[model samples]
Target: MNQPHPSEHYPVIIVGGGQAGLSMSYQLQKRDIRHIVFEKNRIGHSWRADRWDSFCLVTPNWQCRLPDFPYQGDDPKGFMLKDEIVEYIEAFARKVDAPIKQGVAVTRVRRGKQDRLEIRTSDGDYTADHVVVATGGYDIPIVPDYAHSLPQRIAQVHSMHYRNPGQLPPGEVLVVGSGQSGVQIMEDLHLAGRKVHLAVGSAPRSPRLYRGRETTEWLYDLGFYDLTVDRHPLGDEARHKTNHYLTGRNGGHEIDLRRFALEGVKLYGSMAGIQGARLEFKPDLRKNLDEADEVYARIRADIDKYIAANRIGAPEEAPFRKVWEPESEPLSVDADEAGITAIVWAIGFRPDYRWIELPVFDGRGHPQFRRGVTDAPGLYFVGLPWLNTWGSGRFLGIAEDTEYLAATIAERSASQRAAA
Candidate 1:
């Protein structure tokens, strides 16, 4: 295959070589469309850079499969470790023969005159009729303002920078979030012989699995995981709240903080603010989790009713039972004595579009797209949270979104050629 010169124009240009980008490339290749991908780093940077050494996908191998490539492994329900996912991505890229310019960081994507899209990267400039931003949303880790006031002796790390339990000092560790990342890290530190304290935050009650199969499979069957932001109104609501879809397929494996507490992990209310060498917390997280659980139950019931009405085979039902709830007590701990020599902010991430000079961004810094099409013709965005539905932005859920965006670009390209 001949590489296009820097001055040459391609039909399509994709930004970010992660799962979403690679997926789009594969689909375009099948259609015999000429496209080039610009990746800031090597493929699977999330699996390589952000994940811990022992990290594995919360979703099993079966559900983690991409569009054309299924995970060919003995353990379908088994978690794919970080390195394993990276290797899978490499193999996928090789199989598709994707035209990727590795080590080229996209500095900006802007609209050129005459409907041409300009992609400026560190290496050189590239022009295309259409540009797809498949960059996932977890790029920027959001650390709160209170972190700066902490004493110099304490170490602070975001979930993005956390690698292993060995990186922290030997003392009680305070994890300042109850999300999946926070719960997983707390469990890891506790098992590694460190005392663990988890600061509870507003979180949805999600099971590790659902019914007899993985939660993702159940969601797929019911078409729950197939929703896009453009198709589902509830998607926007789900994105605003921390309530996540949890399933009951982990067997006896429970990784929630309550399970850790049974294994000696101390739980606290949400962290309020930082004091001198001390952290203050409010004890209302349990109430919040409980309230969130009730809301989830209602939603689940509605889903079940919909499935039954549509004659969808009933998924194995996992009974929900309230286990651990937060208490109403203000908790405080000395930063030095808590053995929490470090703080890992597993709070969340936000999209950063400073380099993107397009006018599609809304006040919240998210691109304004209608089902992946931007106001600017020939510009599109994929892999955004709540892009069109509940699952539009997830790893296993981007195939539909990519397909829609690709079709739109192809149609537009055809129209332009006809006009020309």
Candidate 2:
């Protein structure tokens, strides 16, 4: 192992150079604060590496608002593709002129001597009066243990590594989970004419358009984007909930698993276990579908009420009708019988903060904080899902969260200078 050089010092050190970290840097620059951002890879690494080729933002481009930068494109209502999204973030990074060190991975962060925080990175050692952890929650791809039970012929890839249908062997593909990524990847495969099977989870559905307007616009008008975790009915539980599944591909539209079923895509309940050559699934296919539809209907109802209350002029549309229903749920599927050659695990990712040696974490390893301000002095967090509001981790609400943390950090720095 290479020895770390003499520790360098900075007034503030930020870990992770994604959207959240970049936004925080922009705020600090506006306040003339001295800070350095450390990124494990180049800027917009996640967007350029993790997402599939057909990926696009589910939200409109108009919501792509950084601190002082907003989407200046003409098609604000249109969703930006994966490449475009990367360019947008890259542009912001250039505009901010952030003092960022790319390809420097922070391996550990712990309390150091003299009441400062020590940051251990691949490059060298450093200490800062204040530290901000901007690493987002999606750090590690999660795969079930049962996946190892499959035969060697069965190829498996996590959603993060999955690029396209051609990346897999030429055979039927099994997609696990019905979250945003799972459903979208399934559609990507189906559109490519691959024989696909899906294990539907309990992720809710979101409407793309209602009353001739984008549903997101309506929701924003209703102040849904401004709803904070504390004020939400489900409280913090809302943070753990899976995001509603929808698609921004080929313009925006709703994703109906029932319609997928109607088009001959095999659908199953939540994956339970794997036995020999058969994959077992819980008999909850019908239940999961029904519940998803219930949420779909509820959202439309809310929009209808909003339209009526505001006396808005909109065309009346027909109520939603079930296009298809499962006659019987299959408990298990024989992998060989179905000619399944590959599996895409889109279940989701787990947060890995093992490097953080501080005691400011919860039982589940989640950081304990009130809108990025932790109980530990000089320790802060940003870019977490639902850190303050529904848009906390998204492009829509990151500016507000980062600005708040910057102000808090600046005030604390001023107070410390006075004391010294």
Candidate 3:
């Protein structure tokens, strides 16, 4: 290990080495801006470590556009699995020569003593005219507090730690939280011949393909991704909503809870708690499923209208039919009674910004930034959820958002030099 240095300064500093951070570095590098990116681990480490072996990007390959190297593979419409994503990111770093200091973890980002922003890292302290928190959104998997109440006999795990079925115990799996991760993992376990039960939450479900086109293409063509927070009716709710229930495995298909129920996977309401060895839940399964179906219906209606008004012909698609329901109100079951030997928390993730010792965060600990610009001077944010548009947190959206932040940083630098 190298000795720690003190007071080294730069024009800009970016935290994280994921796609967001690399994109910001590329943008700054293009303009000859002196900036450094500090990653707690190696580049693409999060995607490599946090994701399961079967994990693939929900977004299509073509939509993963970086600054210089856009995805131009043979399968533009296909999804890239974990390995491919890491390879693409590594190639981007090599191509751009992004000045990323790997293994340097940022401990604190606060206002410096003078005019610059201060950053304390494992390597050393750094001051910069601008700091881009490009850490991206999925930082930590959010397991509920009540999960600790589960019996010691029942092994518990989060989706982030789950690699395969063999890794779990020798009985049924209880998957909590019905978002993207929950459904995907449940399906993986079910196909592996392990009986699985899922606690369906309120997160909406989306079809992999809407009409003849991929759901992404339909939404992209409809300008849904370009919709800003100001334009959305749900506003912050729309911006901060958990990921919809969808899958990118085996060429993508809908992960309908009702379908899962039909396929022998037990369905229950939102997980309430664990009373000793028993797992408690509500009976809102039908209500929750309806809400998800409603959203899907609205989205399809909009797409149909667009095709009709534009005189564009599209194939008539069959509407999703829900024919299966739980026989009666789901009863609280003892862990062993349900044959559940392991419980997996697929409750999604929340961004970790604990290192930022600043007052710029909201009550929820999200940054107080508008379109990537913060209230504090020289303090900027990029790739945060809905910083500009619906896709702001995505790979393609991060690239676009970072470019804007870089331009803003440059303008501020030029003004400061002029004032000096």
Please report the candidate that would top lDDT against the real structure: 2
List the global CA lDDT of all models: 0.75, 0.92, 0.85
For 283-371, candidate 2 gives per-residue lDDT tens digits of 99989998998999999999999999999999888998889888888999899999999999999998999998888988888888889
Q: In candidate 2, which residue pairs get closer than 3 Å at backbone N, Cα or C atoms, i.e. clash?
A: none
Separately for all candidates shown, the number of backbone clashes (residues 3 or more apart, or on different chains) is 15, 0, 0
* Candidate closer to the true structure by lDDT (higher is better), 1 or 2: 2
Residue 8 displacement (Å), model 3 = 0.5
Model 3 agreement with the true structure over 339-373: per-residue lDDT tens digits: 88999998878878898877888888777777889
**Between prediction 1 and prediction 3, which has the larger lDDT?**
3
Name the 10 consecutive residues with the lowest summed lDDT in model 2: 1-10
Query: What TM-score does candidate 1 reach?
Result: 0.89
In candidate 1, stretches whose alpha carbon ends up further than 4 angstroms from where it belongs are: 1-7, 209-211, 230-237, 240-252, 295-320, 324-327
**RMSD to native for every prediction?**
3.8, 1.5, 2.1
* Model 3 poorest 10 in a row by lDDT: 1-10
